[model samples]
Structures are given as C-alpha cells and as structure tokens.
Target: IVIGSGDLAAGIADQLRAHPDIGYDVVGIVPETPDPEEGAVSLGEVEDLPRLVREHRVSDILFVGAGHPDRVLGTLLVKLADAPVTIRVLTDLESITLSQGVAEEFLNLPMLRFERRNLVHLRPWLKRVADFLAAAALLVVTFPVQAVLIVAGLLARPALAWEERHDYRGYPHRIPLFHDPGTGWRGALFRALPPLRYLPSLWPILTGALSFVGPYPEEPDENRAMEDWNLILTRLKPGVLDVTSIADHPWVPFRDPAGLNMYYLQHWSIGLDLQIVLKESLRVWDKEEGESRHG
Candidate 1:
C-alpha cells in the first residue's frame, strides 16, 4: 500500500501504473484524505494501519511521505511488526547508502528498502572497553595542564563556566569548560587552550555516560527541537570531539553534520573509532601549529 498522498506518492503510483511488467498492483493511499487523486481509494488514518492491511490483504507497503520517519515509519512499524509485508522507504541517497538498504532504480528514480537495524548491537561490550581505556588515558595525560589552567582561571575569574548539557538519553550533566565572561585578556587566554576545555568531558566517558567517539552533545532545548533522524542520534553517547570539526578544514571535504553522525552510527566499529581518534588528534596538532605560527 502507498502510505502517502502527496506529489511523490502520486508520482510513484503513476510510474507503477505505466510499468505493467513490474507486476505490482497500486494499493490505496493511507491517512484518509478528503481529496485523493483520480481513481485512488483512501484507507483509514495511519492509526488504523493494521486493520487496513488486513482488510486490503496488503502484501507490500511503500512509505513515500516526506515527514519525519519517527512519526511516519515508526508508527507503521509498531503496529505492523508481525504482519507479512515488504516495506520500502523513500529517503535520500546518503541515508540509503549508510543504512545498507537495498537500492533500486525505477524509471531513473531511486528507491530503497528501509529496514532499520542497530549497527552497534553486537559490540557494545567492546565499545565500553575502548571508552574506558581512552577516557582514562586522556585524563591522566591532561591532568597537569588542566590543573594549571584551573589555577590560572580561578585567580583571574570568580568561577569557571560549567555548561549543563543533555546526553544521548536526554540525561542532564554539567561539563566544565573555559568561558570568557568578558574578563579581558586573561579570560581570553584561558579559552584559547582547547585541551583545558575538554578535560572535564573525560569524567562522563570514564563514568560510562559517554564514549570517546560518538555524536556530539546537544543542549536540552536543541535536542527537543531536533527532527526524528537527529533524535535517533541521541541514542548514542555524546563525545567531546566530533567529525564535523575535523571535516571543516579547508583541505577536508565538507559533510552535512547530521549525515556524518548518521554514517558513524550505521558503520560504528572499534577500528573506525580508533581511526577517528587518530585523525582528530592530527587535526588538533595541525590547528595548534598553525595558531602558534600565526598568533
């Protein structure tokens, strides 16, 4: 059954009607509309998906809506989990490739079967091991520099800045970082040291609330306003560093921030995490070198 009644859904129906050899019937659209296209039936609202599936003897479902998948695809899956139906999701090419969805080209139109799977399900323990080790090592190595910066900041400013941010699971936690409360050059100098800003983030990683490499933390308000796909990202631990900063360099190709995080979620592995860490370290070193030479 076609799950939408918009232009894309109508277009797909038109193409399917033209291709007789494809051997598939055009089922009615869902989320009952007052104005369905010519010769198309309107099934009940999305909440009645299961009943419609049974009544129509639906063998397949094509979700062609441009709405967020959490509301569109998620609602359908919850009701039709046990139903025998082949579901195809229409999404962008990047999401299709990252998700490992089966790709098809019909009349030069890209089609992908949307079967969502947790990419890191099999290696949670391994990821925890890596997070613990990396967090511990970073804390040890950076403690002296952090101490010096803390002392200096305390002497110049009344208090250090502590930002309250939400993690992947929407849990609130305070992260310590240097913020210039417009206290002149001393506060500016404190903010210039990137290592000092990330020292307190090690606590979350050590305590198992975060990973050494994962999605960046979002503010509570920002997290609430995110789209369905971005909300999925909050399921993974937030990291101190993100791929976006590294990818932002002139030499590195620009990537969509959300797409890059989604890519990491779908293709996560211990080895991939290590590679990202190494690249991030190098990027930081190059940045520091350029700053020293220029500043």
Candidate 2:
C-alpha cells in the first residue's frame, strides 16, 4: 500500500507498473488530500487507514508525502502499530534513514525500514535518578556563585528577566536569567559569567521540567518549520548541556545541531549521559578559569 497522492507516489506507482518483474504489486494509494492521480484506486482518506488496511489485507505499506511530515508520519505509525505489516518510510534525512534500521535504495529512491524504539522507555527510572542527583549536587556547589550573581544582577538591573521556552513536548515554561539594563560595567559583569544567568535553570531540572543531558531547548517559533526527524528530537526533555555543544570532538563542529541531537537520542545510554555531564563540567571549569584570569 502506498500513502500519498503526490508526484512521488505517482512516480513510484508508474515504476512498479512498468517493471512487473520486480515481483511486487503497487496495491493502492491513500491520499491525505483530495484528488489522487487519474484512474488511481483511492483508498479513502487517511482517517480510514485502519479500515483500508483490513480490507486490502495490506502486507506492506509505503509512505510518501509532504507538508508537516512529522505529524503525518507519526499518525501513520500509530495507526499501523499492531497491524502485522512491514513499514517503509521515505525521508530526506540520512540520520533518520540510518537510525530506523536497514536502509535500502530501490530504483535510486532511498527508503528507511520503520521500526520504532523509545529511548526513554528503555531506562526511565535510572535517567530520572541521575538527573535528580546531578542537578541537586550542582545547585549546592554553585550556591555561592549564584548568590554573588544575584546581588550583581540587582545592582546592574533591578529587574530579572524570565523568558518562556518550549520543552521537549512543546510545553511552555519560564526560565529566569539576569537582564542587562545597560548599566555599563555592572551589566557587563552579569553578562560575562554564564553561571549566574543559568543558575535559575537548575530549578527546572530539579522539578523534572528539564533534563541534565538531552537536546537543548530552542524557541517554539523557531522550531515551527523543523523537519520530521528534527521534530522527533523535541520529544526528548530539553537539557542544560547538550553533547553536541560539549563533546570536544573534531566532527562536533561539522554536525548540524538537529543531527547531533538525533545522534544523542538514537545512541542514548546512562553511560553516555555520564560522559556528557563530565565533559560539560570540564567545559564550565575551563570557562570560569579563563574568566578569572581576565577579571
């Protein structure tokens, strides 16, 4: 079964029809929008997928479509979860292609074998425990610095700034930081020390709103048009420190932010999380040391 009425689906249908020796049938196309290609068997709308699947006895499903790809793919996956069918998805991201398992090219068309694996589901308890303990310890150790920064921020700018940022599931939460009120040297002091600005974020980590290591948070507006693979990363809790930002590898500089986050999600383990935390701690120490020498 093919899901989509776009040119891609039409082209695939044409190819399969032309080469019957390939030993597979084109089956039918399920169009999300109206008006599938002329004379194509329309398998009702996307909402009727379950009925169509049962009626057609679909052994395999080929998904090809555009527009809000994440939502489209997610919806299809949920519908076919228990349907005993081999799933293949066409996507532009090579990371997704590799992560989904065995990737293959058919007639120069790249497709990923869709097998869902939930990283969080693997060891949720262990991850939560690590997050809680690490966040608490860091907060306790940074108390003195936080105190100094609070005073410095007040002197520079009487009002602190709280900005709303979206978490992994697109839930909005406020994060507190120092605002530069243009008080010259005092404002510069607040800006120079990142520890001061990020101290309040620890509260979110403690409260389970954020994680110690995961994909970094981006503004909701900025991520509105993110691709399906990138959108999947948002399902993970936002972290204060991302592996991509502190991995200390030469290849780290060349990787796209979304690709790096996806890599973390795909290869996530408690041990990997510990490594990220250790690397981040060293990075912070180096930054503070440099600041002290300059100050």
lDDT of each: 0.64, 0.64
The sequence of per-residue lDDT tens digits that candidate 1 reaches over residues 1-295 is: 7776555566566657556567778767774234545335566677777898898888988876666445766776788899988887766343434345567787896555557675433255677888899889988998887677667778776446777555554466666666555546654554354455557778878998766676654445643567556656665566655555434332221244554565555566777787777777666667866775797
Candidate 1, superposed: residue stretches over 4 Å from native: 1-125, 144-159, 163-174, 178-197, 216-232, 245-254
Work out the TM-score per prediction. 0.45, 0.43
| lDDT string, candidate 2, 1-295, tens digits | 7776655576566656566776668777877566645335676777777777788788877776654356556676798788887766655443543444667687896555567665322244567778888779988998887787678766655646776655655466667755656446645665454455666778788888877676655545653677655665655566666657533343231144554566666666778888887777667767866876887
Candidate 2 Cα misplacement greater than 4 A, ranges: 1-122, 152-159, 169-171, 182-186, 216-235, 241-261, 270-295
lDDT of 2: 0.64
Give the C-alpha lDDT of model 1: 0.64
Give the lowest summed-lDDT range of ten residues in model 1. 245-254
244, model 1: CA deviation in Å? 2.1
